[model samples]
Target: MNASLFCMAIFSVTLNAVAQIALRKTMLTLGALPSSLITAFSFLTNLIGNFWFLGGMLCYAVSIGAWMIVLSKAEVSAAYPLLSIGYLITAAIGYFFLGEHVNTTRLIGIGIICIGIVVISRSA
Candidate 1:
């Protein structure tokens, strides 16, 4: 991919990561749900009111638009690996924002994913 396309891909990946993290943050706000249908409905109703969740959905819409741009510029097979970059981005966000742990094993796995993305980008 050229500079603009690559930048778009990175932006798409970043937006996706933000969406995923936002959804996660939204979920954390809701504690364990009751098993009753009425309680579940109430919980769902409250979830709808969250601005962050709505923003996350908007992020998803923009991410799709960016993805479409990437697809128009390159083959899906070559561009798809860029999606996995979301995992890497979200891990860091989760660590800092959510206080989630990122131990050696997770770091190693993320490293492998990074290597794969690098190889795939080179192939395109």
Candidate 2:
């Protein structure tokens, strides 16, 4: 990928990661949804009004726009794997900002993902 495309891919993945984090936080706040129809409708209303949920949706929209641009210029075989970078980004953010655990096994999985990303990028 060219510099601009590479940057766009990074931007897309970062936004995607942010979206995941935001949505996770929103869910943590909202807890489980009600099973009853009326209560479920109320829950849906509350979710739509949530700032974090709206922000997450906006991030996803922007990320998809940037991702579309990247796909136009890059091969899917090479470009799609770049989304895996979002896992690393999300895991770090979760550990640092959200007090989420990052255990040894998860760290090893993240390392493997990093290696895969490097290999895929080089292949492109």
Candidate 3:
């Protein structure tokens, strides 16, 4: 991939990762959703005021734009594997920021994902 296209992919993936982390934090604060729309709306309004929700929304907006650019330049099959980069980043953020576990098996899986991304990039 060209430099600009590669940067776009990275931005898309990073934003996606950050968004996942932010959303997870927001959900933890908000707890489970209520069945009633009114209750849900009220909770959402409160939730939106939280930093995590706003940060996630910002990241999501940026990711959408970057992803469109990436899709324009690369085939979906070639580009879709890039999403795993997001997963890896999100897993790290989840573990570090949210105090989630990162067992040996999961670490090994992440290592495999890194190898896959490297292989895919080389193929492109």
Best by TM-score: 2
The TM-score ranking, best first, is 2, 1, 3
* Local accuracy of candidate 2 as per-residue lDDT tens digits, 1-124: 9999999999999999999999998999888978899799888998999999999999999999999999999999999999999989999999998999999999999999999999989998
Q: Which consecutive 10 residues in model 1 have the weakest lDDT in total?
A: 25-34
lDDT by residue (tens digit), candidate 1, 1-124:
7899988999999999999988887887876766899798888887898777888999999999999999999889988998898889999999998999999999999999999999988988
Ranking of predictions according to lDDT: 2, 1, 3
- TM-score of candidate 1 relative to the true fold: 0.94
lDDT of 3: 0.89
Counting clashing residue pairs in each candidate, in order, gives 0, 0, 0
State which candidate has the highest lDDT: 2
Q: Candidate 2: where is the Cα deviation over 4 Å?
A: none
Q: Clash pairs of candidate 2?
A: none
**Candidate 2 Cα deviation (angstroms), residue 11:** 0.6
- For residues 72-121, write the lDDT of model 3, one tens digit per residue: 99988788888888878888888989999989999899999999999988
Query: Candidate 1: how many backbone clashes?
Result: 0
Query: Local error of candidate 3 at 79, Å?
Result: 1.5
**Candidate 1 clash pair list:** none
